[model samples]
Target: MRVEDGFQPVPFQEDNPYTSDPVLPSLLKRTLPSSAFQEINPDLERLGADVVTTIRPLGSSSRVYPPRLTQYDQWGRRVDDLETSEGWRDLKAYGQKEGLPGIFYERKYNEHSRSYGFAKMLLMVGDVHVVFCPLSMTDGTARVIELMGSAEMKEKILPRLISRDPDVAFTSGQWMTERPGGSDVSQTETVATPTGVNNAFGPQYTLNGFKWFSSATDSHVSVALARTGSPKAGSRGLSLFLVPLRLPLLRSPSDPVPPATSNNIFVHRLKNKIGTQIVPTAELSLEGSEAYLIGNLNEGVKSISPVLNITRVWSAVGSVGGLRRCLAIATAYAKVRSINGGTRLLQDSPLHVSQLAAINVLYRALTHLTFGAVRLLGKSECGVADADELRRLRMLTPIVKAFAAEKACAGMEEAMTALGGAGYMEENGFGRIIRDSLVEKIWEGTTTVLALDLARASQDPAVLNAFLSWVKNVVSSCPSDLHERLQKPLNVVNDAVSELASSLKKPIAPLVPRPALILAGYVTSSTYLLEHVIWSHTTGEDERETDVEVLRRWILEGGMVPATEDVRRATQDTDARVKADSTMIFGRSSRAKL
Candidate 1:
């Protein structure tokens, strides 16, 4: 008799998270100095194996149980500590030692630092159970401070932020949202008034406000926005301040506290989030909190751009990490799966093979797209990027961030289905995979917000030239037969770009148009895959076969629904769309029961 519960392997290999990915090695090889990345490749690859073998299983259990808020000690001291499983702390230690988060700051790695750093981050997030959350904001905060902080701020904070030393290491908070304003930072009511206080910690501003969504609430320091000028100045009027959770207490005779203590940041409550449960996100009440301004006063909105962009990339990487893990699970399950008779391997089933392959195609293309953006980030930061590369890098950010998150949601659902009922069971880990990936679509910025940002970037001439010219060059470079193979999708994509340009000519266009956003992302992602594969072929790297398979699946095989001619037609007819939208939003059905 066969046991019903004996089958553990899904369609995926259950392989090491790092080396198992067919895409990562070649990508790093191409984007980074081969010598630098290759030197570290074995180490990262082994780390990847270690993560799969050790860290992930630990995370699966630890994140499920999650950390709890211990509001007080047994003696009734208000410690406000978030107590977590040892595995959680272990992952943090791994981060410090491996330089997983700080690798982005290592100029020794040359222009490839972002590529190599994010490559490690991509693998780490897969099964580290959203440990990427704090790391993402931490890296972003470090970058922001490095770029805009006063010399003193840099001297005081940068070392700790980038330090691999456990004793000196720090993570940071991004406290941007208030209860009333989600993405609208202009509506932030947090107030910062100069205390007329100056001491060893530099200038001080007293902050009083409520922060609604403070991710990494346990962080030692944070960057926040508050109105330092007229409330009417909106986002432009706000200032960016680096608020340390615990500040150095001046031992003045007039002061009530010790030389170093809590900076008056009170944790009001922890959010019981459906996803990213492992992260200690909380609501905060700041009363007379002290902070130092990081950038120009009232340029807070602009100054925070570096943080926003970097974090969004991490969000994209994290989305792919979740999808990659799910696919790994699904692929392993399919290999040993059988009919009730136990005679036929699910791997031999044509339908099953095709299903997994379809998702793999997406995984491959998105991996290239996301990593390509990282390469551009490094180039731009290192001052090697030309005008065109800079424009592409700038625009590619929103496109990749939104696209990866959207596909991760779709991919995880398919992953769950492939694993049968066990996928829904908590112990199998698919519950967290799907649940965690769901928030990816919501975090950083919702799809609509990112799409709008993408759309705005598409209209600029430099961006347009950078994108269109590259697409044309890539498609045009294909040898005659291969070029012919790509012609239809290329034309379809170019038409979408042309339409976008035409629409932008009209002053009354919506900033957030779904069709335009979808078209831009699909076209660019497809092109990135095709171009990379072709480049590999010319250089003798041998990825062209798989690359062609992905291109045919996503572009030529009618895989992208919104990129089709029909959707394009529907979007162009503004009058009909308006009427349909009005009927849907304003006019209910005539036979409505309500």
Candidate 2:
């Protein structure tokens, strides 16, 4: 009568996130040279094999303890310290040693560096717990310093930020949000008053205000946006600053009193969230904190833009990682789990296989899109991008960020459901996958905001024209058979471009058009897949038939007619009562009446 004696299911445990992913390796082999593969293959394989020992403890127990804030000493002396978890700290060394950031900074593979770095990093995304959180900002921080910081600033900070030695390396925090603004930095209330200081660190600014959301609060340095001129000047009057959490030790004992260890940064509280609990996100107060000006004052928004572009790409990559993980779990679970009162295997179920394959098609399409962004990022950074490539990269960043994020949340949810009731359990990791992926949709920029950005960017004739030309080149080369399959989607995308061009002449109503933006993402992502499929076929060194099957299946899954399918889905919401009730939550005042 014991529970152990009864029927029990075989668990999908001890699988490596890196090794089990058949898709990433295939994509790498087809897109990159064998030498490129040789460089990354060892790292990927090592991460795959040793994953359980290295990252499992970090993942399974990471959220069990959230970060704690310590404000003072027992003697009542002010000593603000943010105490994080062991899992958070222990994974740092391994992450740094893996050289995820180093590869890009060093450009070991020349133009292929960023793609190589991202491909390696993407594989580690699901396994690293939320350590990738700080790493994203840290990578962005290093890039900002490299691009804009003064010679002294870059000399002093960039190496540490990209260092492989844990003792010398540093993670970074990005503090832009305040009480009044989220994505709207024009509403910033933080002020940076120049102290007329011309010291070694440049013009010293006494920052006084609150940063409402500060992820990686325990990091050694940060990039913050603060107002330098008239408050009414809005985002244009803002400036970017490099604030070291702990200043360099006062070169000599004779130097003016050294700044405190915390740089006057006080941790208010950590955000208690449903997921990504491994990353320490805190509310911070920056009062009289020392900071150095970076780039031209009042052009802060424009300067920090590069950082945004970098982080958005990271968010997109992370989103793909989460989706890939969920798919892995679903596929892995099916192979082992029995269904129908243990009479049949879940893998053999036609309904179950169809459900997974359908989502997998979407997943594959998005994978290509996300990696395409990564590849272009490498090309552009290496100065190999032409004018058209630059414009295409600009357009693709937002599309991938918005599409991958939104789709990941939805895709992971379906993946969980495919696992049956077991998916809902905290132990299985699906719950974490669903919750973590939700944040990507909001961070960097919400879907609506990004879609709006896309709408705005499309106003440039070059952006649209550049994208269409690239699409035509790829679609035109698709070997006729594949070209036949691509024609409908290509035609729809061409019409979208034409319509967008017309809309540019007369702006679209109430801007922020969500549907059109989403369709852009779908069209662009599918094109990326088609381009990649064509490349794989041309290479002759990779699996051509499998690539063809994947491309064929993705198109069959309704990827081409994104707008039509979206409209259909929207029209299917026929329940007026449910629709009305759904709005009640957002309509706080109306909810009371309901």
Candidate 3:
């Protein structure tokens, strides 16, 4: 007889991600009006099916074949060319042809268009090897150009940035991080020298400096921040520039191709990163890079602010997508994997299902929080937002970005744990999921940096008052019976809000920023869930029960407030805590003398 192998486990098969997710459709249904939902639902369905069948395979191939750089040609002349895999190229083509960026620009349904476009993103991002990273910058670049670019720049570049035709489309790299500073743009050292000359594209400059981190390095152009004034002028003295990464190849009339020229952008090296490896991130020296000024001089921060807002929203949505993917994998594995010596499937185990439920609950909460911001974005972009919506959008953008990312990191880890030993195996793909999710917490702004931004936003009386009033309005609108049902969790949320309000006046307020931001996220997300539940009841939709259940779970289980002792450590007893932290981290001898 032939040698027999040990018992083999059957491979796991994942259901179509769009159909398998119970929460997303219900969310779109609850958020969009009946007519709008009917109109966009079919597109969402198509993209959902394509995500698993087409986009995912391309994503896998991209990860398998990462990007590389060629610094010199065969004859030893400097070329500085970047090469990406066909799968990466195909994914980019698919995204462009599918109108990932065009959907928002088209605004076919007016303000609902962003929601429609982002819903497709929610379904597509998880399967696409973080290609959304470049797409995010591209969308941000388009938005900035639309709002701030010179008329000529807008007419020439904006359309291509958002074009649906892959051949005509362009992706943009955002180069903000520099060696001297990470998130602190005030410390940026890149300098731009005005050429004192106007090219066809408008005023030109020569930029010289090194960009520490340049994701989407393979992109055709970049929106960068460089000092045009005294270095001591800080961020206010900086100006935004559009830098071309490559020179157009001049083509002969017959050849229809031209000789390649340099834009003076030299890639020092591709980043060896933990995740998002499929995206070509690089360190580069901008040596006399040709640039076009965007907006007025000494207003770089203001010009780039819109781009940050857009990308931050992308980060939030992408974080949720990553968590969703991990959950999909874990959930699929649970059905096929056996336990109790093969007597029962893992899905049959209540404990296992509960583990999955915990992840699901967080995923649902983050989904609402992110999409709520997306809806506001659409309204703002369409010029239909009220003053209140504008302020809400400002505060919520940073909150959702930092909070969703931090929570999703933990949720993705839990999802991995749900898969047992198989999750640790690279072939199972949890490794890439977790690694990619980790970057969300750091990209744009880390949690600490964002917490400070939230603190600043709240300090503005108009912003804080608007948020508080909105919360009150949402709470007061609840129907009586449902209000009674939610009274306890609502009180929990209110209490946290009150604490935040009180802490803002305290001398230790700076110490409270992180906790304060956390409270804000909990409050807003809880409010969104509560609002959805009310809508579910009023609409009598099929998702009412699940909505209520998800709302209750999120309010109760999502850690609505910080612990009292933790608060004390952060605020009231900061001195003692610092000493303890120093001792713990630096050893007993390093503790400060009292």
Candidate 4:
């Protein structure tokens, strides 16, 4: 006889993420031509089902079996052998075969190909255990090589990076951080001396340095920054190089041991991170590692900017993906979950529904912001965009990246709480969602660091003009009746923009960088959301009511614009605020001012 164990919550059952999503298909249909939509939609639906049924289970297994590193052979030889779980390997191979990195280059739908690729990724990321981290770097590296690599380099590496054949495909690493400086690459101490040899890859150089953090340590090749000029040259002293992490894959087994094992790269240890355990990050020592110079010497910063832009976009999308997954689970659970001793379903409860509603608004807005930027990227890459579109993409990149990361972190937390005690449990999977989402804020760039970048870009007259003009154009295009319906929210965005533009003229821009960027993101996202509403009306869609309310709540309930008093305090009450803050932080023994 079994004893009763009280009531057990019904397990949540999530539908296909791609089909259950109300926004993605509509956005794609509105933006792409009918023929292009016809070509992509079916494939997206198939991928959507695969993510839930196949990819998700594999991802869970990956976390269960984390990677291991073996530093020595039985004979006492120094061999840094990194071993990953079978599930991780299978998922990676699956992603490669499905064009995780190749879709961007395939151009099957021309400019729309990026949307197809990103949409597929958006669905897959919810369950891939962050395998996308290394693949993100691979995508960025491909872009760099395609745009900047010499003929030999492009011919050799580009094919493998974009290969659909899993056995032949390659993933790349980005090794930029050093012990002396994390984000500050200007202080890089790595030295690269010319080896005076030209190989199949490119001109050879020997890199000798210690890299503090190398994400995706198991990659085949990496793009690194090393000083090739005077140490005093700051960022200008750094030059970009292509460092192969392993010997040529096609080499015969008896090819003289390839001169050095692991291409003279030694992995000190894998990082014990809070999330993304599936990704093997490492501390590395490049001892006479063979590398090929990428572009003009001492122009590493300028050359690597393109890669940063691409990865930042990936960061934004990854954040939204994580939130969407948690929200879906929470939503599914609420409908069947009962309260009041089975008298009512959780979804029927007003308070619970209200919390879910707020999170939905945030998720929708972030989706628009992230995908809007992706569309601009596609246009710019296809060489079809005019000057203003390019400028808008540049401005939107950091703003969307910073804004989405911060909001998604908060949104995921709220989503977890919606599940009650089950959310706090490790087995339910919300733990992984929250932990992985936090990295989005730190990687690519921290919220504060990206806010500074936004400040610099907003100060540029051209970039500022491009963004403001876009907001005005989008808002003014709204139907007269719809504009009247959304008049209050419209006015809110308009006023916020005016105030931000005014603030940019003063020195307060630096002091209120985060708020300024966030305000701009809200304003920009409002425009995109408004544009979607307009599209719905024009197409005679039935979901216009819910769409309109989402926009309304985003402005009125969500606090799209920061308070003027807060901005004033940041600029005006700086000395008092700083002294108090420092006193509290330092135990009243420090003298500090803002």
Candidate 5:
């Protein structure tokens, strides 16, 4: 039977890590008490069962390194074949049956294919990172969600995707960033001119401008944001287009084949990067690429927000997984490796214990935050009452993206430190984890960019007040005993909000500078507040009684307030001090030279 026949897309489980036992899930449940934890328990258990049933245990010396090469090669060759029509069907059939190919396949392909790396290659070829674009492409997990939602699109693509049958993967490259734009959709410059369907051109758009970094250099399909109405239309003037990568075929092909003629899209060059070397980043020139609009003209950003929201959350999960892997490696090493006295490092040192404990706590908090977001997405998908949940998801996506990415880097760094000198070695995988974790900050969106976005969103009294009220409700609803544990940190957040509201009550100038600082403060304050609230809900105990009770106490005692003040003062003081020091040093040097 064809693999496609066996293909059954697994519904996304918020907490299903591919593993062979219920150990991880049981641990998570023991550690966390969020509603998401309860919701994800069944799925986690199912996934654990699936792992045991499917994967054969390789004996005790089976190396995690040099993963099964033939399987990896087969997957890569299949994807390569899909670049053409005849091969796409066969490959799609395999993918459909097996579900999304894991990172092992991705690593294998990058090693074998010297010409292009994962998502990045698409950018080099001027195709948006769709399926073919390894660097920028959303993984199979996300693609499955998108396919599930659109039966029409699914019907057209699933057969090919599942059968390993070749058909063009119509993954959309998101080209919304600009030179001065920091994830601000309103600041985009690419212009899309709608050309009414003509006998010659057919239904098309003439894209005129540059996109700094585009994914999937070979992807024939892209959803570009362009100015359609007014230059100042900001996001309102922006429109989305579903543009084909190639010119219209004179006639439809007898088989599923990408068109022969190239559209005007061209890759200027690929970006050099620190890690994720398998994925390519491309500079793109859209010198009259033929495109068609998707959704209403003015509602492009709105339509894309949901996609971005979902993808951002997925990215957070990926980062979490990476961090978990880092911690697991570090923990294992700590227990086994000997130190100064021929004792295991973990046993010999209090500092090591503290680091491990801190990492564990962070892992718990971040895992809960990420899983909670995933649960929110699942609940929204399953038609749970989530209007407010959706908004909360929106607010949290940037936070999760920013916070998790930052924490993942920090966590991995700590893991590296825990390993001492050995962590720096590339063979240990800590280096790779560090390199990979760097992208988490810049991926989806940067912290500073998201901070500004949050700040802007906060300016809208409605969004701001609603969010504040929602947080207030969450705080108020906590168990009475938990209130004592939460009250101090909660009060700090409340005070910050009140101060911000007072500042915004009147018109203010230099909006960019001060607002930026305020936004940072807001993210820090809100993140802690949300963390405390979620912890309160999930732990099912008063905050004072839980394991993170110390953390909560730390935040309340002086952690939250001092952190806020330090951020504010540091932002203002650091630059001026640096400039003054530089000036004084240079002047003294010149005088000495004279």
Candidate 6:
């Protein structure tokens, strides 16, 4: 059965079920180069230190904020007061000055409970929930550019935004994804009719349409995508507007600012999601809402891509951090937990050793790839968008999100196995990790969606050719002495790609398990490329050569070949293989279905 078919809560046990293996930790430690630890060690320490400070004061028995408390006490109270102009004024005044909340706010809002990790980090403040709806009315960042573009708007808004006791907070909401339109901005039905000038800030537009799933729903300003051009104009016709949730006033020292107003933007409801629950995902209705245009009329999508690209990288990093945490927790637990009456869990078993070893490789490879992608993103020229950089982000985003999340879930499950029944309990945190990690794959995009994207990217001659060339370049750059060791896996990837290309022309049936195997091999190949690049750069050529040899022999002699065979069998066979020979012929099939 698929891991997600349903939660079958098994009873917690006191003994390890994976056998009396004691070499797991040592085996894992041996496989990872000391250097891999060097790069991440400091950061992990810093994070640990930070967590100590953050969570220590809360005490050991404190629980994540309850969802009902957040809803009834926080959101409800804020909304009821928000119904008043005075309440609106207070929120705007406070938000502008405080810069909103951090992780603390998320904990208050039950976002941790809801699963909005990063978003909660962005929004949550001390004990109270801070609202972000109005501030996100405009494309918060782009609005800065637009306001700067006009000296009048700048004079009016910039000072308060920059002021020590600012009265307004600027946040942005991404509202382009529609129910029926697959990320296609042009197919949006939201309309913005030209409304008469509000005062003298040029032409004002009245937005009247539905915007589903806006991030930063509590912000005061928002940049909303509306149909300003021809309805049939596709993406080019879609224009972005700075929608103000509250009326704006000139930045005057003497004048009394009026109470904040909600305009006509109404929230339909908040989304119940697998993760990122702290940041409210709201369906909004903009009914004759006041809005001003930012940038040229037909360039909204292009303008948004830059910001989205940066956010994507941040998301990738967040996933990596979570995954790393899972690994660390699992490994640490395996090292300390005793299995039987006399022996530690990781001290004596070959199977346990093998599992931990495999996990270590996955963790290290993912870390290098994620960090490398981060570096690549950092290297791209600012302002000018590079398609190559974007493509790389696109390609890596899904892989990191999907693979890291899946591995994290698996790692937690394995860690639980090490703990016997204790790990399965809520108090142990392994169950939480598994619960939380499940959302990572579903978020950004499902694995199925990502696989399709990969398939499509492979079909684009330019993208496909470029990717293949890049892979070849990576293969060529491997240390000469380690070529023999790396050759088998590299060839496996090449053959798979060739076969995939050929299958594109035919109506190939679902390979079921084969796809997972192929995907694993591809990821392994990619990991090798990433690890080589990072290790080579961090260490000298000579050191990298040695490390490469070690990694090569470890991977080849390890379970990779058997794993591939298992994938092939699971995909092609209708019946289960019970015999050892049958299993070996197919490789190691996953006990857990996709």
Using TM-score as the measure, the top candidate is: 4
Best of the candidates, lDDT: 4
Q: After superposition, how far is residue 183 of candidate 6 from its true place, in Å?
A: 4.4
lDDT of each: 0.76, 0.77, 0.84, 0.85, 0.51, 0.48
Q: Of 5 and 6, which scores higher on TM-score?
A: 5
Which pairs of residues collide in candidate 4?
none
Q: Write down the TM-score of every candidate.
A: 0.91, 0.90, 0.95, 0.96, 0.66, 0.64
Residues 15-106, candidate 3: write the lDDT tens digits: 87777886788888777888999978777777777887878787674344778888889999977667788888888888888887889999
Q: Give the distance in Å from residue 576's predicted Cα in candidate 2 to where it truly belongs.
A: 18
After aligning candidate 5 to the native by TM-score, how far in Å is the CA of 311 from where it should be? 2.8
* Model 5 agreement with the true structure over 1-594: per-residue lDDT tens digits: 987795342221212233421123433444344554565456445533432233212111121111111111444431111122222223222222323323212322222111111111111111111122232233332343243323443444323222322233333456766665747768777888777753231335788877887654444455567878787788898876655556552223364554322576655555566754334346667788777555566777875665566557656655665666567667767666665656454646887877866676566556555655555555554456356666655556676767677666787788788877877877566776577567767866777676655555656666556556665676566667666766776677666555544543323222332343333334443444455545546656444244345446434542346545544443455545555666687865554343
RMSD of each: 4.0, 4.4, 2.5, 2.2, 11.8, 11.6
Per-model clash counts, in order, read: 14, 0, 3, 0, 43, 46
Clashes of 3: 3
Q: Between candidates 5 and 6, which one is better according to lDDT?
A: 5
lDDT per residue as tens, model 4, 1-594: 345577866777898898998688888888899999998899889998998888888767534466899988999998888888887788888888888889999898888888888898888887877888888899999999999998987887888998888777888999899998778898998999998898666778999999999998877788999999998998999999988887664444346434225588998989999988878899989999889999889999988887899999999999999988988988998988999998899999999999998999999999998999999999988899899999899889999999899899899889899989988998778898788888998998888888788878877889889988989999889999999999998888888888777765546534678777777788888889999999888778888888899889888777665543345445556667767778888866587333
TM-score of 4: 0.96
Q: Give the candidate order by descending TM-score.
A: 4, 3, 1, 2, 5, 6
Clashes of 1: 14
Q: Which stretches of candidate 1 lie over 4 Å from their true place?
A: 1-13, 60-64, 72-79, 199-202, 249-261, 564-571, 586-594
Q: Order the candidates by lDDT, highest first — what do you get?
A: 4, 3, 2, 1, 5, 6
lDDT of 1 at 410: 87
Report the Cα lDDT for residue 226, model 3.
95
Candidate 6, 1-594: lDDT as tens digits:
898685444333222211121222222223334554344334334433433353223312232231221223444532312222333334334444433222112223231211122222222111112133333222234333433334545555444433325433344556776665645566888888887675344357888888876765654456667887887788888777666655553434465643333476766666676543344566777778888766677777765554444444344434444444444545565665555653545636677766666655555455445554444443342223366655654555445545555554665566567656665766665554455446556544556665565555445556545544566566666666555656776666555445444443223334432354235434444555445634454455544554554455445653445545544554444344434445566655733331
